[model samples]
Target: MKAYAVLVPGLAASAPADADVRAFTETYEYSTQPEGTTSVQLWHTARRVTWDEDYAEEFEHRIEIKHGVSEHWDVATSTVLVQSGRNGLTLDRVVLGPRYRFADRAEWPVDVTLALEAGKVADRSIYPLELRVVAARDIDSLTLAANGIVGVQVGADVIDEVDLAIGWAAGASYQLHNKLRIGAETWGGTADEGPRPPTDGVNASVGPVVHVAPSSKLWVTGTAGFGLTDNADVVAV
Candidate 1:
């Protein structure tokens, strides 16, 4: 059978509830997410902490590896399978958090997201019909959209407040004078209002995505940001 999908990496993938969604596209597509891009990310997060921040530097040499699939990463109909691992050094064990992703452009033609909100363990790795609306234009030099997320975990124990959260993000992508493109995104949200509260903090980050190829099967992108939440958001790699 012809390969409808290629194996890209949802490698930059976060947690279903806490992972940052903006940086996910490049990891999933393993290239550039163009107009007709469709992909999936396999991600996870793990962590251990101590009340005494003094021991924060105690952890060392943590490693992990995971795998999943993607659509439209290398090709539109191509299903890209992905596997990734991670390592870290902190006061405790593997860092934990949820994952997040904005829907593919073709689905909304503007901006949209489907996400879950939990930090420790994932409620479900598959898309669960959780979506956020986006408002933008069709084909413009710059694409801007505003979206938010709200979700709960059913299979696990519920404390009502632990699952409910408020989060929103604004993202934009622009094409420069040449093939070089510029893109940026900002996102933040709050989680854990439960009794045994996982972690009550705000999660926010902003970064730029560079598209060297602009329009090509192969491309490169890198990102950096800070996340403040008690969620388990693990990138496959």
Candidate 2:
């Protein structure tokens, strides 16, 4: 489940027409909120995992607030809560992300954005840092987007060395109406183990996405993801 609330109604009103249409739930788009506008988003996800004879369900909730600093830059902060199996929900992490776009849409073949994120996990000494390159293009009413991501852990606990992880997400969506859109998305990631070829294991999923913007201040996006590898959850929503 997801929701979007714009705080500065006047600024949002003057934004571009497509600014409020989010094509993919898991894919990052190239557009940022209008300058001086703030938007709040809430997200919830649940996944089913099975291993041998054991099965478990995991749930996560996140709330994020994003503010546009300029036409090219936006910053966001989020808090995560998670529950696994029979355990009660607990605070998982806090994250801060800042994104910047290179130029106006259609100025180049594809719009490009750079995103940097940092997070502190609960009870973990290490802090995680992630960098992503987001690229997107609009072809008439259809939109295509992709993201390349790299992440590493830092802090006193990782003073010796750090391993890198690589991931990617891509999606394509077409607007069906002023308030509805549909898309498909796929994402996968691999972690590097010490001295090993980065192929230790992989987690991947692919699924269909639906986005509904009932109004300028409220929007919902949902996806039903199926695992593509042994390491991924059996099903996710």
Which of the numbered candidates is closest to the native, going by highest TM-score? 2
lDDT of 2 by residue, 138-202 (tens): 99989999999999987767654785788988999988997899889998788531122335688
Model 2 CA RMSD to the hidden true structure, in angstroms: 3.4
Error of 1 at 24 (Å): 7.6
Off by over 4 Å in 1: 1-129, 158-162, 177-179, 192-201, 227-237
> Where is the poorest 10-residue window by lDDT in model 1?
73-82
Top-scoring candidate (lDDT):
2
Give the TM-score comparing model 2 with the true structure, all chains together.
0.89
The alpha-carbon lDDT assigned to residue 67 of candidate 1 equals 24
**In order, how many clashes per candidate?**
45, 0
Q: Looking at model 2, report the run of 10 residues with the lowest lDDT sum.
A: 191-200
Candidate 2's displacement at residue 207, Å, is 0.3
Cα error, candidate 1, residue 134 (Å): 2.6
